[model samples]
Target: MHIPDGFLTTPVWATLDAIAIPAVAWTARRAQSELESPDDRRIPLLGVMGAFVFAAQMINFPVGLGTSGHLVGGTLLAITLGPAAAVVVMTAILILQALIFQDGGLVVLGANVLNMAVVGVLAGYLPYRLAGRGKARSAAIFLGGFCSVAASASLALAELLVSGVPMARQLLWFSAGLFLVSGVIEGAITAAATRAIEGMNPLWIREARPARPVTIAVAVLGAAGLLAAGIAVASSAPDALQALLPGSKNAGIPEGRLTKIVLGLAAMILLYAACVIAGRRIARQRSA
Candidate 1:
């Protein structure tokens, strides 16, 4: 779940950010080293895989309790691409959110990135990596997806506790429940997607390397567009945000819903164009 502004206290957010910045930079460097030679053929595939994940996340998984969460795709990506490289791609997605849509606060950027990208990638990849091939790999993917969500939620709750947010005990339970539901959905999605990829392109598991910059850029754009679009769709529906704000009318639909939907479509188009162009270039390169 993308946390909105003002939920976390300034001090707590700031502290989490401080702890997250250097950690992100370090992860980026590690990813670079892990990246295969620039000429490696797997880059294009990885780029496309990232874009596929981005698009997949747009379709929200139905979680009960009137709450739905989008696919985290951390474990799925790690299963397809290596964990270190997945961190790089996931961090890019988070940065896009903080900068473009304002879905998350700039003050909490580092912490958010760490919680969503670093922790998620590691949680998903480590288990699968530890497990050998075959059924173990599948189990790792499921566990990784669940653990990633749990870790991020736990981290968010920890931040709340540190910030002296009122009702830490209550908040902890809420966070646990919310993330547990989200994690189960994510695990199922990850498992199905991973199984499909395994069936269609088992070779993807071996090609965990860096790809062309243009392709990477396009895929990153796609992921960001999909996330924004998903949020826009959610915004159109009944918003818990509005309910939280007292004095807000629960009467008919909100005035801004149409605008959000239109913007989402436009964003989706832009990202599709970018990905198509990048895909073309990649195709040409492959043929050459």
Candidate 2:
């Protein structure tokens, strides 16, 4: 779910932005290292995969009660492109959505990225790896996809509560009910996509590796910091949600049916080109 700007208090989003910047930088570095020897196929695959994810996120299914959920594609990307590359792809998608569509708030861009990209990918990938190979691997893919959405929703709910939204507990339960169903849809999509991709091109699915101890420690600490900051800031501010509502209003882009199709095609082409160039550069560097 893309959080609009006004849902989070200034302090909460600000602190998350700080944490998100460095986390993204780290992910980029990791991706560069991982893709240093990228095969010719991988560059195109990255672009196509990223574009696919971007397009998929635009289709929101009605979850009843006027609520809707779209495909996040974190686990799908991770399963295909590796976690680091998935993070980069997701970051690109989020940035484009924020800047071009105004789908998410620019001010809370960091938090949104952190919640969807970093946390979602890791939550999914870790479980998939732990489940191992064979029959369990298929189940793990479903579990990973389910967990990714659920975890993201949980964090978003926590953020809302910390922002002093009224009836936090009630809203949390309501949102959870919606996501429970949505998560199952995501899991099925992920499992099907994984199977199709594996059948067509096994190389696209990278084997999962355990993170080094230091990396794990840092991630844990970062997550803790985000949670603590949200709680601490929320406790101090009175009417935090009210204060944010004034400036949080979003005027989104309106496009015709043809325009939407054209724009989607253009986005896919642009992402593919960008990824190809980056992949080639990284490949050259390694060769040199």
Candidate 3:
């Protein structure tokens, strides 16, 4: 659930933007350290996973209530790329999606990054970390996928609600139901994919690491900002929220079927190339 720019108040989006900047920096640093295992395969795998997730997010399914959902791919990335690297990949994906495709909002890019990249990936990786190499590996994979979508959707909903976006109680219920179904489907897809990958090469799944306090702290800070934003929005005038929501109202994709398809494919290629180059740089650094 990519929260378009108009969906959040100024304070909420700005606060998330503030949090996401440093969080992303920290994850990039962590990613470098985490990939220090000298495995060249992991480098190319990073590009592949990023491209796969980027492609997967483009094909949305109707989730009702005039909204749609996609595979998201945060869980799968975390499982394969390691959480920190997953965060880096997702940040790239979101940035490209916002900047080039206009599939999301530049003004609220930080909020979307916080929701899906940071919180979603970590939440998904939590179960795997807890059940490392245990008999419940399959269950953990499913749970990771479930938590990834649920956490992201819930945060997006809260952002909208706290932004004073009027929603019927029934509509909220419908959203919860839709996300629940989406979560289950995500879980199944992730599990099946993991099974197939393991059948071919278990090493593709990043060996789970112990949970880190700093990682948890980053997530907690993001959530806490969300909570504070919600409180502020709850107490503010609806008119105030409406006024703040229109930051860069003219910012949207141009309408044309052929142009979009061409642009989309071009963007995907550029993103893949960028990720591959970054992966190589990181690999070279680690090797050095």
Candidate 4:
């Protein structure tokens, strides 16, 4: 879902970035405020969980068009972290993806972050909250996650359209039509991951900062070394190569993809390393 760099003109990217900068800052502040209650520990937990979600995204799912998409994991984070903080966690994930993995472009970072982080988390969590406590929890979790994925995909398509991308109708139709498919997959993945984490340490289920240093380290490494590689190759070769083979060129990258891949990976890798070290330190402190 990383809209490569250059997909949008300079003006659009610049405008979106300007808006994203403040929006992200506001989200962080909001998360901090939310942490003032009984779930202070959820702050670190959410951060680490965000990293884990990044790790899971490395496993790509084939969409059958010779192109594949990975899990966004927004709902999974929201289910565990709560709404406000979930945005912060996802913002971190998106930043790392755009910068280190080259999954998305820096110019379009704001749009991607807003769609995947803010919209997904808020939409997903609303259903979960409405479902209310206990036994209904899993059902709420699935629906919330499903809705989030659908909403994120729709919003992303809309952003692309508004940015003056050429394939507005096609892109929107492609994305929206896949909603049911994406929704089912997202729901199942979110449910499974949440259940696994909750089962591993029920305390995590109750909202405590993650204290697993090793898990944090592995997650960072996975995103940086493995997933980043996936993003790099996935965005570059297949689409571009296909474009060169007669009749396939029309479906190929829209000019600036190469640049987006380079810049995006560079940014994501740098951020991934920084986040890993920071997360490890936080994990160590929590364990101590």
Instruction: Judging by TM-score against the true structure, name the best candidate.
Output: 3
**C-alpha positional error of residue 24 in candidate 1 after TM-score superposition, expressed in Å:** 2.1
Summarize candidate 3's per-residue lDDT along 1-288 as a digit string, tens digits.
777778888887888899889999988877777776766556676777788887876777665688766677888888887888899998988888888878779999988998899889987887676554556678888998998898888888777777777876557668878888889878877887788888999888888654445544544554455445444543543333334335423557564444444554565556645744553443344334
Q: For model 4, how does the per-residue alpha-carbon lDDT over 186-272 read when each residue is reduced to its tens digit? A: 887777777888888865543433434544543554344334333433353444323323563454536566655665578677887
Is 1 or 2 the stronger prediction by lDDT? 2
TM-score-wise, the better of 2 and 3 is 3
TM-score of each: 0.63, 0.70, 0.71, 0.60
Give the winner by TM-score: 3 or 4: 3
Per-residue error at 142 for model 4, in Å?
1.0
Clash count of each predicted structure = 1, 0, 0, 9
Query: All candidates' lDDT scores?
Result: 0.64, 0.71, 0.73, 0.66
Where model 4 places Cα greater than 4 Å from the true spot, the runs are 9-15, 36-47, 59-70, 168-172, 206-288
Error of 4 at 193 (Å): 2.4
Tens-place lDDT per residue, model 2, 1-288, is: 788899998877988799889999998888877865655545566677788987877877665689776677999888777788898888888898899988888888988898888888877776565453544678889988998888777677667666766654345457768778878878877887788888998987877543344434544554454445444434543244224334322435353444434544565556645744553443344334
Model 3's lDDT to the true fold? 0.73
- lDDT, residue 56, model 2: 79
Worst 10 residues of 2 by lDDT: 240-249
Error of 2 at 197 (Å): 1.5
Better of 1 and 3 by TM-score: 3
lDDT of 4: 0.66
